[model samples]
Target chain A: MSGIFNSSIGRKFAMALSALFLMFFLLQHFAINILSVFSPDAFNEASHFMGTFWAVQYILQPILIFGVIFHFVMGFILELKNNKARQISYAKNNGSANSSWMSRNMIWSGLAILAFMVLHFIDFWIPEMNTKYVLGDMSGMHNGEFRYFHELVEKFHSPIRVGAYVIAFVFLALHLLHGFSSAFQSIGANNKYTKSLQGFAKIYAIGIPLGFIFIALYHHLTGH
Target chain B: MNLTLKIWRQKNASDKGKMVDYQISDVSPDMSFLEMLDVLNDQIITKGEEPVAFDHDCREGICGMCSLYINGEAHGPDRGVTTCQLHMRKFKDGDTIYIEPFRAKAFPVIKDLVVDRSAFDRIQHAGGFISVNTSGNTQDANAIPIAKEAADTAMDAATCIGCGACVATCKNSSAMLFVGAKVSQYALLPQGQVEATDRVLNMVKQMDEEGFGNCTNTGACEVECPKGISLENIARMNSEYLKASLKG
Candidate 1:
């Protein structure tokens, strides 16, 4: 495993696997969040269901947390190794004029996304989980349902909190645009299939985050 | 046609470089870009000032040595030719052109528009060769039948003049195109298979060690390349590097 980490191919494979895992997690998270647009009552009920589920809280959440941590740590470590390798004879001319901005800024963008994730978990996930699990307070009623529906709506009412969510979603989109296609290429998926994958990844990269942002904006604008 | 030139001037690598203005009146519109520079140099010598120094071994478009960053574009405004082949007719009279040497952390200006490109040569020396020996009575050259498509691609990859245009146009100063060409040239040929893994790994290692930036696949190098080298070579190199990494 150490040898694989040291090798160029090993690092790429690690990146691909981690990226795919993260993408799956993103889809799951997006699906749950999208429910807010249809009905806050339904969303809170769904959130309550998820918050109370023993399997998700005990088994899947830990695995998801591990995946996120592993992906972040490995991405940084690989980038550092590549940077160290390129530091020799630093006076050579950079003759490549045709690379992209996003490709070069991956590390910085990744750091931004990582910081956003920490804030995100603390802002919502912790409170949602804690109120349901620890305090056992699932208050408020809307449309004949006893759920934390009011709390969910009340949180987005704050302009500062909504702005933070919007900003973090932007960073997430930027990360996904580059990360999606890069992951596929790293895994030797460079063919006709690769083009469609890149296109789909690009759409998802924009669509999912925008979907989350719209929900926050819609709630804030409607005075919910 | 007359044009004003703002060319970079420096005594040597140790001296500070700056842009110096020069005016040439009544220049012919048909003169090639280098020929216009030559006319300016002659006037500079008549005024007892040192002539501008730039690299241009082949007047034709083949030798990759004629590197010029003209008006913020590599090899001037033209799409698929070197500075030596760029015609003055592309510019109108009374135009102000800013000419500078290709600037990168790895490529230091030696004098005027000339930069020390020995770094590229050094990276090549790291492992840009096959390990075959030239013993007498070797196997027939035609013994191995390579596909026509592969042969054509190899020829295209072999066209890289090592001119550093890719670096000049790249936002990250990545040498992925040049390095890719070198790696693909060998990876496509059976003669290069015996030591393919070592060759790619060493070359990539040397490339990174030289302080060039990472490839972002922006396709700018392809646009600026005098020979019009494709980014497919880069994709090929990435694949080769990945495969080689797995073997170890």
Candidate 2:
């Protein structure tokens, strides 16, 4: 079973599986974040439960960390091998005929997403962990408002941060546009349903990232 | 027609190759692409110069012998045809065409416009066959009642001539399409059921040993394949591989 990771298709299969898992977590996190825009009390209630829950802390967080690390490390390794496969360059090469540019340049968007992920962790995840394990829940509390919601709104108050978030979401959208359906195709899920899968993936690729950007811009413009 | 050709030139596999330009005149539009090259070779020979060497046989296009990346497109600008079937009519007067060998880490240039494709043979030898008892007992082909769809798909996969154009056209030089076609063709047939597990596992392992890159789902192989092999075959191969791996 360990040999599976060494094969080309097998490596791609793992990449797709991890990507889909991360996407699921992203949607869950997005849903949680949107709650703050609606009501602070509701946001804090969910955040408190998420932070203190045993299953969420012990199992889910560790798996999420592994998934993220595997995705990044394997992605870079595969890109390196791909680069080594074609050493000499084509002088008059043309690319528009068969593949999308986004499919060809995944590493660029992926790197940008990695950069944003660090900041995202710093802004939310680290503080959540601190409150849950070491620091008390009152670390950043203000005026009886939820610390998580307050921290999120405060983070977006900086236009520079909001702008970076919006740009990272754009890169996320570009990465997902090719990554979504291609992940399914990579794992051999093709059939009559694949066309519909592609359609749904397109909507997902656009919608989720745009939703994130809207949330950031909404906070920046309207001071949510 | 008059054309300028920049053709890759090399003495042997170890020799460095460079594009050498040549002028050819009086080319007929009716000539096949190889025939146009034949005229150029004759001109070079008459001038007491070494003729450019390229791989080709069965100029009708089925043999998959002709391998060239012309004008940056594998097998020239035409779709679903090998270089032998490409006509000069697609090119125009005063055209400057670039001709080179297929580039891939697994495919080293053997000489001017010729690369060693024996890596494909090694990959095929790794699995591309079914195990059948040849001692006294033989099964009739008519005895196996295969569905029409399965038979058609097997034929579609069997059409790949192993020309290496897919490798040439691919950005990563991935041989997944070629390996996928071979694996799916056998997997689709009842006779292949006996060795399906080992066939996929060995062929895929051999493909990796050949140093081919990973498939990025670019769909370029299906586009440039002379046989018009479908990308769906790749998906089928992946399904077959996964099933086999899980069984282990």
Candidate 3:
């Protein structure tokens, strides 16, 4: 295991696997958020179902949290390790202006995303869980089920809250644009197909985040 | 043509360096880049001022001794040519050029523009040679019957003159492209395979020990390389390093 970490391929494999897992998680999260655009009631009900799913809450949530932590930690470690290995200085101006801005700003973008994630969880998940379980707010629902769903929509209706969501989604899109293509190359997947994959990744990165942004912006614009 | 030059001047490795400016006029456009510098030195000589010290031998690009950072670009503005091969025509009349020594922790500046790139020699010493004895009696050149593709690739890799341009152009100051080329040259040949694993591991270790930065695979080195060495060599080396680490 130590040898695996020591090897170049091993480090690359670790980066690729972690990035792929994160990409999958992004897709799932995006799908759930997109539901709000179509029907807020359905999205809230789904969110309530997800919160109450005992198997997912107990088993999968822990693993998902571990995956995110591992990905972030490993990325920092790899960048530092790479910094240590260099010897000579480039005599020319560094980094072409033509290169993708996301690639150049990956570390900063990732940091932004990480900060946003903390804010996002605090804004939605924690409050919803606290109101449901701790305070026992079962007042405004069809059944005695979680009314935390309706509360999520009401939170998004505020201009400041909607603005924060839009900002967070922008950072997420920036992170994914670089991370997606880089993950593939790190895994030794360079080919003609890699170019196409990069294009697709860029589109998905923009589209998914925009999907979430639309939900927040739409709610802020429309009353219900 | 008259021009102002700012050249880095350092007496020794421990000496603190500073850029000293000089003005030269009536420079011939046909003069090679080094010749123009020589002309400037001659003017400084008549005034009893110390000449700007720099490295050069065999003014041809092959020797790799004439390392320079001209106007923030390695080996000046020309692509696929060394500083020695660069001509005054590349510059216009009355232009100001900022020249400096190749700055890196590994390659310590010996004087104005010369650095002790013997670190690269040390890396080569670690594992860059074949163990086969060569007396007056040796196998015929064609005995191995190397495939043309392999032979071409080996030749391409062998073209790396150890100029340190790749290191200078890299963001992390990584020597991966240079080390990769050397490793690939040997790894692709039958004469080089018997000790391939040991060669790569030892070379890579020496490169790291020299305090070179890691490769980010940005391909800047390829763009600025005097010989246009491909980043594919780095990829090849990555593969070799993987195999060696796994096997060992």
Candidate 4:
């Protein structure tokens, strides 16, 4: 509701919900991308299905884009408001005495992830959109073969691209390290199960990003 | 103990504050942090200079009147104690202590080391009480058969003394912990159930209106709270607010 979006807690709840969506999307994206390392045919078939599927293209894609945009815009707004809350800076502050570095620097890490997202869209989504929508090429074919896996491999062939991805994934790790548990806390999910949940959050945060890094490194090192 | 004090001094609410350094000697280890400040004030009085102005009343740690950001830690580097209860033994001889007021737009500096915490008062005034029809029909406190665990949790939340340490220590200057405690103190009780929805909605509205930041769950507030108010109160408030908004 409009009222929900109007309040501070409501905005945070929305932010946490969007973060959860994006994190889920990241997991699936990693799952699909990692397929290129293990089985290129499977990766191509999966990517082709996702690209051409009517339900995914029409329904989920728009929602995913909205979620991403909402997360970023809301994050910037909250950061600005939070900055205004403390008009006078502390003469001395020992933030690390009680909180972690990742927790304190979420905005910086979030911005890093945003920068990588721009590059990622440029390298993949924009071209895919141009090919599928602009050129009206629904076939998902090039050179009489499935182009998804080949395009992914071709993109990673650039050392610069691979290096950029590696750095982005590192920032992704840092962002998720604080963000995963933080989202749950924002939603008031803190309870006895919170300890185990935080443990799981840590694994998912570190593991998923590391998986993406490995996939990128595998493709870059394999020279394929 | 001989010590160097770098204390923030401002003439009034409108004055630009600056850190003025002073050297004091023969500070007894047994003296509380406030007592040591009293010693420094005596010295300033003897020299016909304006003494530092800070907030303190009970000096026994329960009043929550005293607030100081000492050496970058709220209540001067001690855990579970206010500035009034912080002992001089926590510091070494020849230590240079930096003291400043709790910095937040909602909590502006009123004078040297004193901030106007009336923002907390405003938030409290919003919904920090349960409605009682006091027409010579006061009910017995025990008439409401409250569960012991809930009562204990409510008591823990009630232990919060409206200290600004949480706001001072929070990176975002979020007052969520303070507002959470106030909300939870009522939300966890049968007597408080009637107005629970309005309490959370109004208090949170006032808190945001007062320019407190949104909580990031960094949890510095819980660590620095003199009463050791848990972060669970915040979670409770979030859930309460969510339920209230959805119900409406």
Candidate 5:
């Protein structure tokens, strides 16, 4: 309903929904990207299918973009409103005594991830779009071969880029460390199952980003 | 114990406050923090200077009237105790203690170490009640059997003393724990179900209007709460609000 997004709870609920959506997308993205390490042919096959498939390209991609944008915009708005709610901060706040550093610094971590997203989009998504939509080349091919694996390898050849990526993934881990379980709490899922869910959240939070870092390093060290 | 006190001094609502330092000696370790402040105020009175003003009632801690941010921790360094209940033994001899009011836009300072928390009263006024028939008809207390678990949970939610420690300690100054406890105290009971929808919807509306921040589930409020109100109450309120909104 229209009124649902107006209240604090409603706004948080919306944020949680978008967060869960984006989390799912990240998992699938990681799944595909990991293929570049194990099997470049399979990676290219998955990448080409993902790129060229009409349903994924037309339907899911737009929703994914919207989810990302919505999450960021809403997060910014909440952060601004929350800052204003204090007006004047405590003379000396001992936030670490009660809350985790990651919990308190979600915005900074999120900003780091946002910066990474911009680089990621520029490095991969924009060029993919240009090749597929702008240049009218939906074939996922360049010079009679699939370009996905070669382009992926080419992108990882730079140590600076890899370093930036590794740092970004670290930030992503911090973000998810708080965010994954936090999204569940926001949606009112706190119960007997919450403990196990937190266990799973810890694994996903550390593991997924670690997995992404492994993929990036694997390509960078091996491809060279 | 000899202590140097840095207490916030503000004349009135419009006055900009500053921390004013005073030295006090022979403070008994058994004395409560408020009692220590009383000793300091007595020292100022003897010096022919105006004494510092802070809110307190029933010094035993149940009234929730006492609020002091001491040494960067709400209710001082003690866990699970109100400022009135915080004993001086926690601090070392010759300690320099800093005392300030609970900081939040919703809880603006009224005087030295006193903040106006009527914003909470306003939110309470919105829906923190249930309608019961009383004209020649009243339900017996034991007429409706409540599940033991539900009753115990509701009692836990009800134990919140409405202290602003949660807000003061929160990085965002969120009052979700307070509002969530209020909502859960009702939502968990069968008597509260009839008007549950409107109660949650209206309370949340009033809560936002009070300029309080949203919960990020940092778990800070729970840690700082004297009564140990759980984060589960907040999740309960979230689910309640969601169900109410979607029902429309």
Candidate 6:
């Protein structure tokens, strides 16, 4: 069992598995964020529930944090291992001739996502948690909602932050374009349905990230 | 056609190699890539210089011995061929070409354009075979029936020439495709069932021991492989390794 993760393919399997877990996590995140557009009260209720839910706080959040760390750390380590594998590089390498740009620059894409995550955590998760738990600032509680709708609206008010987010989502889209299909390929789940899955992957890869960018843009322009 | 060649030169395994230039004219377009190298060596020898030593046996593509990373692509710019099979026609007149050995820490440069690929032999020895009784008449070869789908896939895996193109083309210097081919060939057939568990476990361990890099599924190996070995073999190998892990 230990040997499985120690092998080359074994280690890659770990990376793919973690990336898939994170992908599922992002789907839920996007769904909740999109709710703020159609109905702010519903978004607030959902956010409050997520912020205070026992299972999410105690169990799922830890797993999510672990997943993010594992994905990036393993990715960094693999990049280093690969670099060491080739002590000498080609003087003229045309990486784009065969593979996609996202596939070849996964490390860079991942780094961009990582940097975005730190800013995101500061903007939302940190303040939200500090208010609810650390500072005990949950004064605006209703039936269950904490009236946290403006937090989403407030963050998008900054043009710089919104612009940074849009750019990050672009990288996110590029990352998913490769990551969605590649995660499936790494686990050996591909079959006759692979083409359709790749097609679906293309749509999802473009759709979700673009959806998030729209949410940010809507809040910024409307100031709602 | 006249051509300028920039070929890697190293005196020994540990020597710091550099690319040396040579110009040759009257090259026929029908000549093979290795044949062009032969012309270059012949010219160098007549000028009191040591002729470049490269590894080659069969001029055809099957042997997988003629390993060269040419113009940034493995086995030259042509697809589905080895260095031995690449022809001079791929280049135009007054063209400059660069030739270098397949670079991987595991593949040490032995001489000009020749790296030690015996590491492949060692990985194969680890667990690339099936156990069977051969001292006596083994049951009729056709007695045990295999699904045609399984047979075809197994044959596809078996076609890997072990040329190290996958390793060379891989950004990480990964040997997964090569190891995947060996693992999948045995895992697909009935003969390999007896020790399928240990076979995968042992082979993966051996591959890691050889200091090869990880597979990122860049698909360059399948693109450049002379035999057109599929990336499906790597996927299949992953499944086998996972299934083997569950047996514990």
lDDT of 2 by residue, A138-221 (tens): 434567655767677888899889989989999999999999988888789988999899899999999999988887877778
Model 4 global lDDT (CA atoms, 0 to 1) = 0.92
For B64-148, candidate 1 gives per-residue lDDT tens digits of 8888888778888887899999998888889988888876667778889897777788778877777755697678758989999
Q: lDDT tens digits, residues B10-93, model 6?
A: 999989989999899999999999999999888999999988888888888888898988988888899889999999999999
Error of 4 at B70 (Å): 0.8
For model 1, how does the per-residue alpha-carbon lDDT over A1-224 read when each residue is reduced to its tens digit?
22544445446667777789889878887787778778776777777677667797788888888888888898787666545433322222233333455665678878888887887788778876677668776553446765565666777898998898898888888888888887776665566577788889899999998998998898889876
How far residue B218's Cα lies from its native spot in candidate 1, in Å, is 2.9
TM-score of 1: 0.81
Q: In model 6, which runs have C-alpha deviations exceeding 4 angstroms?
A: A138-146
lDDT of 2 by residue, B93-139 (tens): 99999998999989899889888888899999999987777887788
Over B25-95, each residue of candidate 5 has an lDDT whose tens digit, in order, gives: 99999999999889988989999998999999988879999999988888988899999999999999989
Docking class of 1: incorrect
List DockQ for all candidates.
Answer: 0.23, 0.69, 0.31, 0.77, 0.82, 0.72
DockQ of 3: 0.31
- Weakest 10 consecutive residues of candidate 2 chain B by summed lDDT: B130-139
Residue A87 shift from truth in candidate 2, angstroms: 2.7
For model 5, the superposed segments whose C-alpha errors exceed 4 Å read none
Tell me the TM-score of each prediction against the true structure. Answer: 0.81, 0.95, 0.82, 0.98, 0.98, 0.97
Give candidate 3's error at residue B143 in angstroms. 3.8
Best by DockQ: 5
Retained true contacts (fraction), each candidate: 0.13, 0.67, 0.23, 0.76, 0.77, 0.67
**Over 4 Å off, model 3:** A1-17, A39-67, A70-94, A97-104, A125-155, A158-179, A191-219, A222-224, B133-141, B145-147
What's the best-to-worst order under DockQ? 5, 4, 6, 2, 3, 1
lDDT of each residue in A1-224, candidate 5, tens digit only: 56789889999998999999999999999999989888889999999999999899999999999999999999999999999999876777788888899999999999999999999999999999988889998888889999999999999999999999999999999999999999999999999999999999999999999999998899899982
